[model samples]
Target: MLPAMGDNVVVSTMELEKLLSMKGGKGEASYVNNSQAQAMHAKSMLHLLKETLDRVEVEASREMPFVVVDLGCSCGINTINVVDVMIKHIMKRYEGLGLDPPEFSAFFSDLPSNDFNTLFQLLPPMPNYGVSMEECLAAKNHRSYFAAGVPGSFYRRLFPARSINVFHSAFSLHWLSQVPEAVTEKRSSAYNKGRVFIHGANEITAIAYKKQFQTDLAAFLRSRSVEMKRGGSMFLVCLGRTSLDPTDQGGAGLLFGTHFQDAWDDLVLQGLISSEKRDSFNIPVYAPSLQDFKEVVEGDGSFAIHKLEVFKGGSPLVVDQPDNASQVGKALANTCRSVSGVLVDAHIGEDLSHELFLRVEHRATCHGKDLLEQLQFYHIVASLSFVQS
Candidate 1:
């Protein structure tokens, strides 16, 4: 069950560890949908990634082990692909300089509840759960690469000062540590009702979300600032909005929240959910405006915004099923449910999940499957270089 909401607390009350893990294995519960989308998003940023890596490689000491941190690296399927890209680029740069590449240590950090054992199983060894990084590396024809799982929230410190050389995060950081207090307050004018997220919210709801994002992002930058070395680079890709207003069609507006609202309203009509409960529960996710992100990073003063580009890419959730609306709806529903079911179940009840998503699929079909052909959400990719002084 979802925990009781807090009142007037400055600290986060959300159990981030419990809230964020991908479903273990390839079962229907698995976050393969999110991971696939994330991997594709990462692939789209390879050019920027390579550029940041090239810059990091120039200042890297050949003698010290090159460290790369993949923040919010959930089951390591997509994480491995991203790390592979970083390793490949580093190797090319070393070869160009007539020097052997430095030994690589890639740390996959996520919440403590993440399925690390399952992640480790996907390594070269067939079935060893207790194997060290050295054993895993030795088993495969490895390219001087080693892997370890560092379980922790990225919002807090995970490593010693100046420990990480390169930082990469995809499809993470939009999640707030907890729901903003103002929206949850009963007396406050910012109360957000009948929605899990603030996509089509009122002006007060938008301000509450933006304030929370600013605070959380400040903490994120500060933590990364401590971990990253001088002159190091960090690449971040997250869902963002082109328009400053939360209600604008350009940002997350209709693309995300409308579906949830549709399903919630359906449940309300069916008497499966109460209006009061619906009004109280809100999803702890935000798609910041591009300007919002730029100001936060620039204001932090720890990292220089090297490049910030907002692009729209294809969502992997929208599979090809033009002739079959049912199939298309199911595909989109399954993809979203894999990541959001737990939250929905927690807020409402486990029993309602099946019914809720059934309504969702029906709504999707009625809304036309063509809408799934292209995901109109924005992808804000930022390349940042840590300041020397």
Candidate 2:
């Protein structure tokens, strides 16, 4: 078991799998309703996806289906949209070749706690494919594929060898497999005493986070390399930093600013929670720069990079309209809550989690305009091809 911080919380790999998931369901705070930013980011990569499909080599066997899997596909409309777009692009590519598109099997993969029920419910009804679940869903207007859910950590092997043809993931890879244990040790120099994230932490803490990211990303690539066919393609979009410095405020730092720490500090000051409790909590997320990512992929040597670039994402809230600061803050807060609320709730109780985000919302409202101006939600977009041995 991995120590999650204080002595009270010990997390096994399986427990971490269960805890690290987006807020489920279609409620206001759920990931489904609050994933507009993720949707926009996924749409930004459609051109790259098309390019990847054009370059991918698909077998012309009707007996073997073309398998496409979306890793870290949380329950949301964005997940559905991404799969639909990929299928359309693949079909178009095959039609241009004057060949019938092969049957497709779409796999939606995530942690065990993901809202698979809601995700399946949101999928469009499928035509009779003679599959066991007649109600099984597929991409909208494209019944050529059958859909199935694969629930597990993508850090581990989730598929048979040489099975997948195309893989896509967006805004997901930055998540570390688990928080660096050293940072949680009070006696260690890497202890992140005052911050819930490494964005503005000290050098030792930052190094610990970077090392963990490298390890996790390498493991992820290694697993995918085994599962992907020789000519298979992978298009990944994850949060990234523009600068090599982990503490730079221009990149992902803008999104996870001092507001969270401030809120926690306030709670501690108010005697709602102990300082030790606040110090023990840290978010297991790191946004690597392009160089950082390249180092890992090149080190793995299982996939050749076709394209890798950094791009910024747009805000989820309405920025064009007037008097939208409150709206913007609310949107940003909801977005953060959707992604990290589970972690916060697990550390503190749900009631304190609610109180904490209330403070976060207020802070975001006060600084919404500044965030809009300075925020650069950089993403490292990579198109890779499996390197044949």
Candidate 3:
């Protein structure tokens, strides 16, 4: 049964852990197929990643493996690609220093509901570092890093103190631990009636979202500070807004565009879902402004910031070709579905969830040109070193 989202009900952290996850498996609707945009975003930061790695001081020890972790590593080839790149670069850095590279141990982490089985299945038997199959097999024990899955929320501790040597998280931190309880309470000033997200919402609603993000991010940093080794490097990439105004959509306007809101309205209008239920459903996500992000990390004081900057990228949808509106709309719908399908399904059931996205696709098709114009993607990338004290 779907959890009740009554006017007085508060969405708990445990509830979110159960409900939030990408559409799993290898099917057309799976996140693995629809995450090209996320993959591209991560790829764009490779230079920064390499630079951060170069700054990372590797303490060689035969007794301890060189540990690295990718948090929020949803099921995809992208996760594997990232792990492969990090391993290869670290190995190269070791060879450049004329020292034997310690055996690598790459940990993939995410919520318990993430498609870990698929991620494991997708991993290559040996790390692909431009080596021949024969060579890879011969040096498997020596050259290839060990791979393991660690399932949990990044907002909590997942490893032993000072255990992880390096950490990377891409497009994940925007997810809040839970929807702010006040936003769901009808009596509260921050009640977010008729909205599924904070974008374009009133000031009170936006503030509620911002506070939740601050709390969740702080917890995330505190947990990582305990787990990361002294001088270890961490790289992060997450969606962000360009404007300081909490409600300003900027380029992310496309994500929470009128079309998305209209889809929910359609459901309510058709009596497919109760108005109360519609009101209660809110996506637990927040794209902080660059300043908002910087302030949180600075306040934490457990890590020294090396690089913090915002970059813009074109829409992940392939819209360069003629008659691209329909394609772009389909892509947008699929992307949204892949990311939020589980939540919608849990809230409205499978049949209505399918109906909801179909409406989203149709509406997105009609507004494709306008959406494309406003569809620029903005991300904040940061590199930090864990400070031992």
Candidate 4:
């Protein structure tokens, strides 16, 4: 019943502004994106592209640098990882054509707050050896640009006019907190605590929030329209939610409350607040349903979808651990245990959050489910290209 794609539901630029700083609830914390995760996914994507190139008759040469860009370049590790993919693919393609590879510049981009120092750390060696991060020494390229992205929303202006080639964003986007007003009327009423489906609630507010999503999505595509060159490819990957009900949302990000839920639960056990307080609060998560993703992408006239894939239901990490399930549970809990203080309101009271680790371990041990064993996280991958006007 919400606005379909192309409605151009006008929204205030200011409201979108608030989402810029919105934080996900404790369960939404990130730990999967280390150097390894980055490399694994990046390489996989590279292989897929290489296979595609083998079958296609294309016209790209190293003489004129082809562009490769990563949005939400968080600290730039993943961007570097993605660029690694491009270089390898280019080399592979060159070998096939018997041509020397061209020099390409990577546009590492993200929110203004991104830690450039971290990104710069990876680049003292400008021309990373043709293969891997490890193979190359640090080198800097003045051509490598670090710039502030669109200020208020991803839907706004982000890059120069028609300057992008292949655009890639991973584990980013989908950070917008669902329209806050949509899920709550009561000051404390929030997502997954009977917000979206409340029959007697303020439908106007909810509609307003939903409209915001449409607006943001349009803006996002519009930005891509401006930033990306015609016929360029884009790969978007992010977490998604199945339930639209405001009262129920569960996933890797929401479950890992790994630290926050623990602290709050202890406070509840101590009679500090109702167990339901967690309801008013959700990790600032707004993972859309599969339909939501499709509608937005196809609805936008700017791009045509090339492919959409969903990966869910597995412990991609823990499954390979040599130990049995219980041992794996212990290991997962133990490794994440130290994250308690940094992730939660640990300063509010001494280790109020540390208690969460114990409960996590206990649940993982007794209930016989590691985080992934529970099988809650869902990933969505959608590829799209600009539609010719």
**Which candidate order results from sorting by lDDT in descending order?**
3, 2, 1, 4
The local distance difference test score of model 1 is 0.73
Report model 4's TM-score to 2 decimal places: 0.66
Alpha carbon lDDT at 121, candidate 1: 67
For each candidate, the alpha-carbon lDDT, in order, equals 0.73, 0.81, 0.83, 0.50
Judge candidate 1 at residue 257 and give its lDDT. 64
Clashes of 4: 17
Quote the positional error of residue 46 for candidate 3 in Å: 0.6
Give the winner by lDDT: 3
Q: What is residue 323's positional error in candidate 4, in angstroms?
A: 4.5
Candidate 3 or 1, higher lDDT: 3
Worst 10 residues of 4 by lDDT: 1-10
lDDT of 2 by residue, 1-389 (tens): 21234433434466678889999888888998887767776777788888887778966766778889999999987888888778777877777787766777899999998889999888876666574322232333535567999999999899999999999999899988888888888888998887777878898888888898999999999999999988999999888877878766344565565677688888999998888888777778899888889999999999989899987776544344535778767766787788888888888878888999899889888987776666557788999999899
Candidate 1 structure quality by residue, lDDT tens digits, 1-389 = 55533323222444645665655566654675445656676777789888888788454455777889898887757887788779767767776887755677889898886778777766542326665534544455443466788988888899999888899998788777778887867678888766657877788888888888888889999999999977689999887877768555343444446665688888788887677667767767788878889889989999888789887756545455666778767765676676667666666666777777777778776765565654466778889999987
TM-score of 1: 0.89
- Model 3 stretches with alpha carbons more than 4 Å out: 1-8, 127-143, 319-322
Predicted candidate 3 versus true structure: per-residue lDDT over 162-281, tens digit per residue:
889889999899889999998888888998888887878889998998899988989999999999988799999888878888887655556755666789899999988887888788
Q: Model 4: per-residue lDDT, tens digit, 1-389?
A: 11111111122235334323212122323322222343455555554454432432224554555567777665535566566655556456666777654555577665554445556666535443354332332233422222223333355676787767677777666554233553433443333342212222344543444455556666688788887766677777765556664223345443444333554566668875454443343333445566667877777778777677665533323435534656545544643432222323312233444455555656555544445455455666677777767
